[model samples]
Target: MMFDKVIAAVDKKLERFDPIWQAENGVGGQRDRYYDKTGVAKWREWRGVKDTMVDYGAWLKNLASMAMMVASAPIPCLKGFWEYRWMGSYLGTFMFIDRLFEGFRGYELVTAHKCMHAIVRSLTKKIAFCLSNDRRLGGGKDTDRIVPMDEVLPPLFMMGFKELVPFPLQTLPEFIICDVDQHIEPYYIDVAESFGLPADVCSRCAAETGVALDDAFPLIGKAMISTNMPCNASEATSMFQRRRIGMPDFPVTLAMIHNEPGAHPYSTQMLKDAIAFVEKEYGVKYDWDNLFKYAKLMNEQNTIELEKWDYFKTPYSALCGIAETLYRLYAWASVNGTDPYFNKVDRQVIKIMRKAYEEKKEPFGGRTRHRAFLWGPSAVYYTDFPTWIQNCWGINIVLNMDSTMGHNMINTEDPDEAIKDLALFSEKATMRHHAVGGWDNVNAIWEWAKNFNCDMVLMNDNIACKGMLGVHALMEEQARDLGFHFIFIEHDLEDCRTVSRQDMRNCVNGYMSVVLGEEPLDPTLVEFDDSDAY
Candidate 1:
């Protein structure tokens, strides 16, 4: 399921990165960006050619892009109007706009990566198309050139290389797990077992491995770039995939910054060579200047996100629990810095808080019955359970490990600093965060959870991940020391076949109703035998 093109009909009408489309929409401008006719597209500012160059023509063309989006939006919006089933898809359209202006947050972060890329590309195309309508500069003599989609590579098909290839995941359809989760996870997971990947291996890794070993997933790129970030499984899968695809794979072994103090510096310098390797692979030169510019934007994004996080610390936030977690993933986890949407969202958050404070209103009716925090990944068993907790039980989840662990800090002054910062921060993100030492992650999760006034600590346990299972006692002890109510749930955040949605709902319902002495059962959850597919 190449969801990136699920809405291709609408996408074709609003071509991204093509100038001709914008001109047709009446916003015409210049074509050629004469400053650097190189493979990497960038503004004059990126070349250290002074950031003062006024591109009024580009502005004029963007007006046309805006106009085109408004005029063409009804086509997509109509999908939402038909029925409630299309509602998530319809709301997804709005989420695209939301992400367009505010970057990742809400539905934008929690949905499939292909869906995320599609949404972002849809905007980029509109803007690119609008900019392509240059009828102004030098009598519309030049046009901004973009690597045509047909010619574009599948971005770094793995996580670690994104620092060099900006918006790496944005270019491909991640069908292995996300867009086609139900069909792929269930089918490929079994395939993984059949292919001799020990059942004890992390299911997430096994899923990716099985797909690559059998060549089940789509071939977005001939080559793959991956890392041994926190486990050997990634290396094993990436190696097998490289062999299967008949292309060389570039894999980096991540360093624990805490133990290896020079890890960030060494990794940053190495990534420069890594970028060159990528350039050779894709036959495209690395945009070093543009990299710094993107870092600046990412730095700006991180700054605003920290400010946005402060809102949740208030007695109650309009940014409730799961919604907060969703936005957290959106702002910090994905392709955030490439656009101005994040800054716009950051500013909008200030307005939201200001209005809330002025009206003396709480995000909840009064106050949250319990201030909660998730130590592992957010729950996928029930997509709406977090919202259910907030409205029905008055419990608000303000923090989580997946989105917040490596996001506490980042640097953006220049290429080197930003690279080092990313290396350091990423070392502390994801599964790597907990691998620093024995029970170190347990304490860290508590520290951050407590920092945000989280009194109730919850975890949606992945039964298949034996590593976390080994640390359960330590995590419980830490929670007990902090005087926090800790609840560990058995379910996979990405795979629901292990535990059904109703099964989890009953578990959570028991905790909130019976354990916490809250209100009566929500009665909202239903017995969905096949909830995973939903």
Candidate 2:
């Protein structure tokens, strides 16, 4: 009782330091809650009594998910922790969840937590299964049943092999962990460079190469399916992976410059060949019935997703910022219509979004001053940039480059027609469709911005990406010609050590304060050191 009373008094004192409270009382500093140079908050954010309970409940759910993962495979989980460097970084998952939705409340908070918990539950199960079956950890029965593939390759078609698991090899070791802990990727990036791989290559590719060289990727599959996708940089990384993995491998090189009508046939045939290779290696049949079932689920998710976009154009969208983007990135890329749970989540989210729109309930209590269309791959380390912008400045990111991936509907009845439809969809995967598909695809940002009714563009400039380097001048000139406020936030993709989080924040701070001549809604967030933050 005494402890609770003390905490309440401290929280009340801290409330006066909050900008909203300061506006009324005229006392205290908001940034006092944190120790200098670190993200360790001295106290939890006080969001009144009700919202704090809701936030705490969601945090507990995530903790339970992690506990269940370890309980399901205790020995293997322990072995994984001992064997893998990346396992230690997953401890920051709770902190990552807390930081991502820092200022959120009400329906937006509920929606964000629901979407995030689904990801957490799914990823935890995946980690447990991968660790149990990992040959490096004394291979369980399902080891041969796992089919390791490039993380960028859409796993929807792999559902046709009913008996096998389609595992994204790099996700466990490198991709997802980088988002949780910024410090994790640099070690791998350094490993790649020290191995005589050039330092100028894309950090994403370099990190994967480093993972391969360090032998961190789990040995879980009979054969590996590699791809020349997202970009040419991945081709070399895939090669390094194949060599280190030492498995029978199939190269699925889909068409680049894929906007033309002629590209579908080539990409479609490649998908077929990939299927044939898998069948031959695994001694499994391509079950058309199985693939069709997932296709219908995929179709439903895409249909609902399109409906959600209509609400995004209005002021009443309950889902905006990082909650919308991060969920879509994982659901569309990682789950890809194969999981029934995501389809369920999609249906539930859309219903909430529709009700919010009908009631005219706006996100962030309608504080949005500008609607921006975010283009290019976002910095994985600073994944909550969208959330920070809306809290500090009133910029609502209506859409991100990754969220716009692969929405085409798949035909369920016919095999021949379905593969072709899938080709059209797969070609649009993440960076493959927009960043490197061609100049026409790259230039189509104007049309997208217009459709979404965005007044500004916050373009990500990943310094090491060779493909996007040449388009800077053209994009800047076009932004001016089209009469839009534009800013380039620069970072080295996954490597936070190179650009640092503060540098990225200053990009917006300078633009908002100097260029637009605007003051921050929360001055506490305008400039703080999260350089030591997880």
Candidate 3:
């Protein structure tokens, strides 16, 4: 009876496990090696080879007989044994399929499977705990313990894990959290650390099991805080500094005002126009004195009275003013050969807003949301405006519509599309323009870098995406040849928590160094000293 129940469950799962669903869920596709015929053949070949090395046929036969006996046993006497045995069988079959698929594709299947296993184990453990405690699980308390929908599912999926997991498992939060906290996080951390980060950096990695376990075992929030603290400060400071110096100066700083609330475009063409104007007005040569004068005048003209416009309406105009002011400062720096401090200006902006938001200060106005502007000599030469004035001020920059490599490509099914997309994005999105794609091959990437004169290349290594590893390696090699710096960051774009603030900072710092031709300030210098706190 026990064996019959287990088989029945497996049969049901198999019948319900749609190939279309698997394809939609990221377990099938061109990138998934297991789905391909060649990969399947290879796995079968491997299985045959492995079978010759051991008496696996006999072992399986004996196990099958025992399973049958257990399944047919009296229901009351075999309930516990059947449940345990059947669950193992279910998982073992699932893993076998996963491994076979991975072996055929020439990709490591361990990461995804480990994640699945973790989730399964976690759920089982939690159910066992709840059963032991004689407590009903539901409502807000259950919601609090539930793994975030994003955390349990792969990013490639359109839906959340809550929508994908077996209905029986959805009630078990501890199980999902445990699997991720135990299995998946460690794998990611291990891969990240293998890149030769310093011991201190490794220790600070939030995904480290030792750190996670410390939080899990004790039910302590403080352990969680300590694990994440190091990277946060490092990252924030790095991004702040990168924007300060790496941004170049241009003539006509134009920005698009997002009509929608809280929807700021990370890149805009209006700013590009301002940059172009600065370039033509000042000439190819850096003319500090005149540039500053022009910027000051522009700022004065753009400034508006607080009473005239809504707060949102004011941000665009204020952004224009800030851009003008920054240009003036950049001009001053050119002649003096000294760094212009942006921290003071930034602090002032913060101060003005703090009063408006917190203090309920009178006349809540004069606030702006302009973070930074892009500028460089490249903007000037790239323009093709007929009129000298129009050419100088033309901000015909195109925004990158698709940032992902797979999404950006015209022929995503073909591996060579990676090379094509990279070249197209770079060429189309030069200077004021922006495009996104990753490298397909080393030679293709090298060619693009040389042609476009890229100063830096950033790569994200997702351990789950086995198809991208070779391309990543090629990108690193191409970076060396093209005389550009390469910076690799580990991140799950879908799961923001996977990337700490410090990781972002380090990446930004590396990019700044490449763009500015200078070393960034050390994270340690900016770190607040808390040792003396009571």
Best by lDDT: 2
Residue 479 miss distance in model 3 (angstroms): 3.9
lDDT of 3 by residue, 258-362 (tens): 222232222123222322333343233223343343333222222321111122122222212112222222212111111122222323433344444344432
| Tens-digit lDDT string for candidate 1 (1-534) | 465455454446545333223323445211221122211113221111111112222233444544555455443323223321212222233222221111112221222222233334444443233223222211111221221111011121112233332333211222212322333354556777897777766666666666555554323333445556555554565566556656445565556444367666665565555556666666665554555555666666666667657866766355555545545554454444555665555556556655665566665445357787776553441244564455345566676665564543444345556566666665654556653323555567777777888888777677766556677787778777879988887766445566655677666777776877766322222222334233
Steric clash count of candidate 1: 16
lDDT of 2 at 185: 88
Better by TM-score, candidate 3 or 2: 2
TM-score of 3: 0.21
TM-scores for the candidates:
0.66, 0.95, 0.21
139, model 3: CA deviation in Å? 7.5
Instruction: Give the better candidate number (1 or 2) by lDDT.
Output: 2
Q: Which segments of model 2 are wrong by more than 4 Å?
A: 1-31, 376-383
Worst ten in a row by lDDT for model 2: 23-32
For 1-534, candidate 2 gives per-residue lDDT tens digits of 987787677768656544445523445334556688765678766665556788999999999999999999999999999999999999888878877887787678888888999899999999999999999999999999999998888899898899999998888888788888888889999999999999889999999999999999999989999999889999999999999889999998989988899988999999999999999999999998999999899899889889989998898888888888888888988899888998888888998999999899988777789999888464833557888888778898888888888999998999999999998898888688668878998888888888999999888888998888899899999999999999988989898888888788899999999999998877777888888877
Per TM-score, the best of the predicted structures is 2
lDDT of 2: 0.86
| C-alpha lDDT (0 to 100) for residue 75 of candidate 1 | 38
